[model samples]
Target: MTKFADIKGFVFDLDGVITDTSILHGTAWHQLADSLGVTWTKELGDGLKGISRMDSLEMILKAGHKENDYTQAQKEELAAQKNTNYVAEVDKMTPANILPGMKAFLDDLRAKGYQLSLASASKNAPRVLGKLGLTDYFPKIVDPASLKHGKPDPEIYTKGAELLNLDPAQCIGLEDAAAGVQAINGAGETSLGIGDATELGAADMVFADTSAVTLANIAKHLD
Candidate 1:
C-alpha cells in the first residue's frame, strides 16, 4: 500500500482528467473525417482519447479506407489541419473549462508539497493549461512534442516522473482514459482512474470524478 503522503509527485492527464476537451477533439476529428469523405462515428471518437494526433489520424485513415491513399507527408498535413481545428476550439477555453474540483484538488496537493507535472498526448497542452489559468501549477509538462510514444507506452508517464526528479514508484498518475491507466501502471506508478470503474479497471484505484478524489481517499492506498 502506498500513502498519499508517501507520494512525492503527481502526474495528470490533460484532456479528460483536467478538462472536458475530449468533445472538442472529437468534433475536430469528425470534421476532418467529413472533409475526407470518411464515415465518422462516436465509437471512433472514443478510440482517439489518450492517443497522439498522428496515431488518431492513422486510425481515422484506416477506418476510412484511405490509409494507403495518402503519403506520410499528406497524413502529416491532415493531422496538422485537425490540430488547427482543435486549437481553434481550445483557444476559446477559459478557467471555467477545468473540471469540477480540479483547481481545489491541485491546490490541496500543492499545499501538501507534492510536485506536479502534466503528461498529455496533446501538443496543445500548454495552450489549454494557459487558457485554464493552470500553467503555473505544473512546472513540468510532457506534451506530444516531448513524447516519442503516446499513452499505453508508458514513456510519457516515466518522462513526467523524471522531470519531477522522482521515481515512478514515488508518483501517482491520475487519468481518465483506459490507455492512460495502463500507461500509469506500466510506468510502475500508482494509478488513480478518474472515470468509469469498468473502463479503467487497470487502475490501482478508481474515482468516479474529480469531486470524488480526496487526500483521504488517496491516503487509504497506504493501507
Candidate 2:
C-alpha cells in the first residue's frame, strides 16, 4: 500500500537545504566563543549542523576544554546570547537569500498539491523562512521547543510527517547534513541529500546542490 508514488509530503531542513545560513550561524557561535575565550575552529562549527543549540554549545565547550566551567543557567544564558547574535544576521536576510532553484522547486511542489513541512532544529526556522519569503510554503514547522531530541533521532521528522497528516513512507525529506539524512531515513521517508554523494551516502538520493534538486529529477528517480 505504501507506493513510492504515494510521496505526497516533503519535510525540509532549513539551513543548507533552503538557503545558506551556515555562515550566519558560524558568526554567531564564533562571537560567543570569543566572548568566553574559547578558540573557534571551522571543524567545530561544521559539527554543529543538524544538532540542537545546546548540543552545539556542549560540543564547543568540550572542544575548548570548558565543558565543566558553566552552570546550566549560565549555559542557557550563553545559548540565548548566541541566538541573539544569530538573529541579528537573520534579520538582514531577504527572498534573494533563498538558494538557486529552491523557490522554483517549492513552487512546483506546491502547484502539484504536495504538502510541505519544516523539521529544522533551529528555533529561528519560522523567522528565517519569513525573511526568505518562504513562510507560506511551509505551514507546518515542527517546533524545536516541543522536541525532546534532535536530528539523527527521527523525532523531528516523524513529528513533521505527523503535522502533514501523512505517514513517513508518504514523504520525502530533504537535508544537507548527515544527521538530517539519518533522521529522515530513520523516520522511513525517502531522503534526498543536497550534498556530495560520498558525504551523504545514506540518503536515498544525492544532489550536488539545490540547483540539481528538481522535481523532474526526483520524479525520474521515483519512476
Candidate 3:
C-alpha cells in the first residue's frame, strides 16, 4: 500500500469524528422514520455515512419506503429538525462527548507543521465546534452552506483544499462516514476513514474511531 506521508496537512469530518454525534444523528433519523412510518435500521443508517443531513434525509426517504419521497421543503424541514435535535442533545456535551485523544492529536499535528481544517456535512458545524471548544483546532471549516452539493460530490473536500491553498493529493482527510470516504476519494486525496469500521470498509483504511487516529498513526503515513 502507498503511504501518504508526503501529505502536508490533515482535514477532518465533524459530527461522528470530533463530536460523537452519530447516535444523535441516528436518533433524529429514526424520528424521521417514525413520522414516515418506516424503520431506520442500523445498516440503513450506516449507509448514510459521510453524507450531509440533507442528503441523509434524501437517502432516508428512499431507504424508508422508496415510494414516499421528500420534497425540497420537506427535506429542508427534516434537516432542520435533525439540527434542532442535535443541538439540544449536545447542548450538554461539554467535554464528555468530544472524542478522547482528539486534543492531543490536533496538537501533535499542528506541532508537526501540518495545517488542520474541517469538512463536515453538518450545517451547524461552526456552532458545534464552538460548543466543544474545538473551533480553535481548525480555522477552516467547509460545510453544506458553502457548497452546491454535499458528500460523495467532493465539492466540500475540494473546497477545504482550496481554502488551505493545498492540492487535494497533498492532504489526508479523516472521516467517519462512507460518504465522507467517497468524497475524499473523489477529491483525489488520501482518505483515512474513522468512526465505525464496518460502515467504512470501502475506505483505504478504517480506524476504530477518532480515538485511534493518533500522531503515531499519522507518522506511519508520513513518507
Which one is best on lDDT?
A: 2
Local error of candidate 1 at 172, Å? 0.9
Tens-digit lDDT track of model 3 for 1-223: 4456667878888866777777777776777677777776889878775455667877877776653565678778777887777678767667566888887788888887888888876666777788788877888887566689777889988988887899888888888778889999999888888857688877876778677888677656555
Compared to the true structure, candidate 1 yields what TM-score?
A: 0.86
Candidate 1 per-residue lDDT, tens place, 134-210, comes to 98998899856756776699999999999999999999999988988999999999999998999999899999998
Candidate 1: C-alpha RMSD to true structure equals 2.4
Clashes per model (N, Cα, C within 3 A): 0, 0, 5
The Cα error of candidate 1 at residue 58, in Å, is 5.1
Whole-model lDDT per candidate: 0.89, 0.91, 0.77
Output the TM-score of candidate 2.
0.87
lDDT of 2 by residue, 107-142 (tens): 999999999999988778899999999999989999
Clashing residue pairs in candidate 1 are none
- Against the correct fold, how does model 3 do in TM-score? 0.75
Residue 143 of candidate 3: its Cα lDDT? 58
Query: Which sequence of candidate numbers ranks them by lDDT, best first?
Result: 2, 1, 3
**Backbone clash tally for model 2?**
0
Off by over 4 Å in 2: 1-4, 58-72
Which consecutive 10 residues in model 2 have the weakest lDDT in total? 1-10
Ranked by TM-score, the better of candidates 1 and 3 is 1
